[model samples]
Target: MKILVCVKRVIDYNVKVRVKADQSDVDLTNVKMALNPFCEIAVEEAVRLKEQGKADEVVVVSIGPKAVQEQLRTALALGADRAIQIETEAAPEALNTAKLLAKVVEQEQPGLVLMGKQSIDSDNNQTGQMLAALIGAPQATFAYSLELDAEQVVVTREVDGGLKTLALKLPAVVTTDLRLNEPRYVKLPDIMKAKKKPLAVETPDGLGVALKQHQTVLKVEAPGQRQAGIRVDSVDALLDKLKNEAKVI
Candidate 1:
């Protein structure tokens, strides 16, 4: 099986975010960038499949600004066989990205495509689903575990309260969850070997894909802060507050 894993480059989750002066987006001027944490999990899962000899090859693909090639390299270092970057200068949004990925998916014709359920920077969680829809492939989102048989793929997904399983035909799409797999670090030798891995770059126009506006970002601001609450000295006091002071009972 040939696996295509989509990755993204985003501001590191550990770094504090600063909204741009215009409040349209976060400032990336000096912010540290890293692989999307969830996407990394997807990459790790694909690598494991290859190591098990269940997969023939792993192709890591990213659709975003040219800087995203760094993210693709990170996946290659993690054990992907090759990387493809659909270069774009447009701001990161779900529809445009899905469109570009759809074009590449047409060209690559991988048996399976896997990506993260969502990105840390933009938690929209729309790209993978949209891409699957465009390609007319069966999709399993938030998959925590996956098992493939001769003609079908089985996925255990994380639902609100518990897990649910679904079986889909081959050539499907799967979005991974946080506990899907543990990511491994690239050793020094693999990091050096990644330098020579094939990295293909293409533009939106080069892929014959066009953009259409589906939505706009009005502003991005810090989420509302929580107000401090009074502390009770004893269990009885806490019960009293909830029953009478707070008027719940």
Candidate 2:
């Protein structure tokens, strides 16, 4: 059976984010871009399934600008069989992205679908669940571990108190959590081989999916700077400041 892994291009986790001068959005010019960490974990899991002889193929897909192909290539270098790019100038919102992915799911008919529990850039954590609902498939989110059986897949997920396990039937959706698996390092030879692998590009219009904005951004602004703390001579002074200046007490 085939496994489809969805990935996203995001700002590297290490880079310090800067707000644009006009406060329209985060400044992305010359920013260091990388695959969403959660997406990498999802791709790694799909590749492992193929390596263990459980899956016949692992296909990686991303929805973004032409630049997203760079991330698709990275997924191929990590062991995905092929890549598909849904070319768009700007990233769509969570619901629209889910709709687009639903179209891909219908066309691919993979035995299982895997993606990040949330994209780091947006952190909406709704795409996978939304896609599951739209496609009428069972979904397991925040998956920490997975076991593939003949007709069903068991997933252990992180919950509020502890971990919970569920068995989902074939042709299901699973979103990877942070502890799912560590992504392997990309090798130089694999990078070269990925270049030769099949990479297809499709647009939302071609997929019959509309990229509509359900919400509007009123304004983007930097957070207020925190004030520095002042040292007090004794507990009395601290209490005085708290009662008078800070007014906590």
Candidate 3:
């Protein structure tokens, strides 16, 4: 089976985010960029499926400016057979990104589609479901474990109360959770080999996906500094503070 995985470029999780001075958006000037951690997990899962002989090919794709190809190459290094970049000047919102991915899904027609539950930069967990909706495919989100057969895939997902399992037929979409699997570290040999892998670039217009703006960010701000905690002498003092100064009561 051919497995298609979606990856994303974002500020490295280790980097501290800084809001723009004008509060227009988060300041990205010269920030360190890396593949989204969850997306890396998706790529790792795809590669594992291939290694296990459950999949014939693993293809990775990303959406963004040319810079996104770096993350695509990273996926290739992680063992994807090929990479595709849906080139866009600015990062598109979730729905538009889903639309673009739907086009690719139509073209690639892979047996399975995989992606992260959410992108850390936006924390918008909408793309996978939206892509499934646009493509009319069965979807399982927040999958922590997956079992696959010729015709269907069984997914175990985490829920607030416990875990939920579902079986989805082929040509389905699955969003991976952190527990899916630990991603393997890329080796130097693999990194060198990834440079030789085929990397195709396509545009939204070429894919017939018209970009549309559905929401606007009025402003962006950093969270306010956390207040220091006060020590209470006893439970009564804590109760008094909660009932009065903190106004919990």
Question: RMSD in angstroms, all models?
Answer: 1.7, 2.5, 2.0
TM-score, predicted candidate 3 vs. hidden true structure: 0.93
lDDT of 2 by residue, 23-87 (tens): 88999999999999999999999999999999999999999999999999999999999999999
Model 1 vs. true fold: TM = 0.93
lDDT for each residue of candidate 1 in 1-249, tens digit (9 for 90 to 100): 889999999999899888888887888898899999999999999999889888888999987778898888899999999999887675457888888888888998888899999999878899889999999999999999998655677999999999999999978889999989889978989888998999998888898977888777788887788999998899999999999888897
TM-score of each: 0.93, 0.92, 0.93
List residue ranges in candidate 2 displaced over 4 A: 228-249
Q: State the C-alpha lDDT per candidate.
A: 0.89, 0.94, 0.95
Model 3: CA > 4 A from native: 230-249
What is the alpha-carbon lDDT for the whole of candidate 3?
0.95
Q: 173 in model 2: Cα distance from truth in Å?
A: 0.6
Q: List the residue pairs that clash in candidate 2.
A: none
**Tens digits of lDDT, candidate 3, 1-249:** 999999899999999999999999999999999999999999999999999999999999999999999999999999999999999998899999999999999999999999999999999999999999999999999998999878999999988888999999899999999999999999999999999999999999999988999999999999999999989999999999999999988
Error of 2 at 64 (Å): 1.1
